[model samples]
Target: MTPVPEPLPRRVTVHLVTGGPAGPRLFGARVLFGQDPADVARRLGGLSEEAPLIALDVITEIASTPGRVPTPLHVDRVVFATPEAVDAWPAVLPPHGMEPMLAELVAEEPAPAVDRPRLRRMASYGIVTDPTGRIMLSLIADGFPGAGTWHLPGGGVDPGEDVRSALRREVWEETGQQGVVGRLITVSSHHRVPLTGHEVYAVWVFSHVHVAHPGPARVLEENGSTADCAWFTPDQLGGVRLSATTRRGLEHLVGPA
Candidate 1:
């Protein structure tokens, strides 16, 4: 009788899909083992290219079950697969690494993972009133919320930066006016669907301001999105297009504009 050749050592790996936050994904895959170690590696590598964000490593299919590893006939060296190398033929093998996803996989009292919404906070627009009681509004040339429309002269407040300082810098940059930042008039927020289709919540702080008779309003930010800056009374705003954000801001700052 002729001797039979033993099959090369290779195992099927499955991400083991389960209910709950189980791993990064349902973590299941169909793997084929070839007689050649290199061919087996090639098949595993091919499976990895589709998911760019995840990390896949090769391991002996000993206990290839949901978040479980069984005893292995043999283990391969270099199991961790890199995304870029996955496309190459017979790519380098990486060492086996832990699947932290397993820890995330909850078998009891399962709760599905949820992605929470994000938030952006900024504000410091000043209601710099003249004797006429009109506030300083700057016309935006481009960018979000409003373009070719007027809004209060201020911008986003940097983290750990004084709100008053940020307001002053914004006022100076957009309208080139120096003023004393006064009491916070109101804090207002508006929610809208941004271009990314994600909900965005913006909160701003509007403050009462006092300033002397200032020089001509100059746009200090060179080639900035602000096309023009000036003081305008509510009556003058009759024809101007007000951004929804500005409308909400105005509703909170003074009265309906």
Candidate 2:
């Protein structure tokens, strides 16, 4: 029998890049263990902008920069976006992006208690509801986390995939339903040791998706994490065994389920 291969460990680095007439400059970078990097950056810089967090796919942008500060750290990806882009999600920020205190924001963040290999992932989920106000949910397939429990229809965002596009694809694959993506509801994170025995950190972005006309729901993906799908009235949800995140999202979007 062939042994199952473990997933490669993952890490995230949040870099404070400044923008202005002087051009984009690498301000500082920090390795985040389990906390959400965007939220940390927001609190540290006191940014009031409501733009999306952008992911940096290239490493040379940080590794081969001039005047870069050295830290005892390693990372897998970087998030580079300015908070001052007014009407557009520009590739960089404006002159007034970060506060002057950003240089001192390079302190290392706390890691998870377990010292196993770390994997950080961002996923997009939807609180899918039809015009009739019934919520749609999917059942977890056997062998995955929360097996047999009902869960929100979504999964990890693929590499180079757009967040909203990923959510729409996941909704259709897991529930065979289409929804118009709406305002972002909330961002939630959870850390755990999974069956693979890896230290997994999941950052979930939840949004409100509305379906105009509905149809019978079913799982469309082959051998996917979702085993089944169905629509539930608000009263009926109380008896369903919902995944922790699903329950949390439900309580946040609507009333307690």
Candidate models: Cα lDDT each: 0.53, 0.66
TM-score, model 1 to reference: 0.51
Candidate 1: give the clashing pairs.
15-27, 22-105, 63-70, 78-93, 78-94, 78-95, 79-94
lDDT of 2 by residue, 1-257 (tens): 99995433233445445456766544334435566656655544456556454433223111211247542222223344463422233345446542222333334456647566777776788899999999999999999989999999988876545557888999999988988988666665777766666787877767788989787798899988999999998889889899987987898766776
- Find the candidate with the highest TM-score and give its number: 2
Error of 2 at 93 (Å): 5.4
Q: Where does model 1 exceed 4 Å of error? A: 1-119, 194-196, 252-254
User: Over all chains combined, what TM-score does candidate 2 have?
Assistant: 0.64
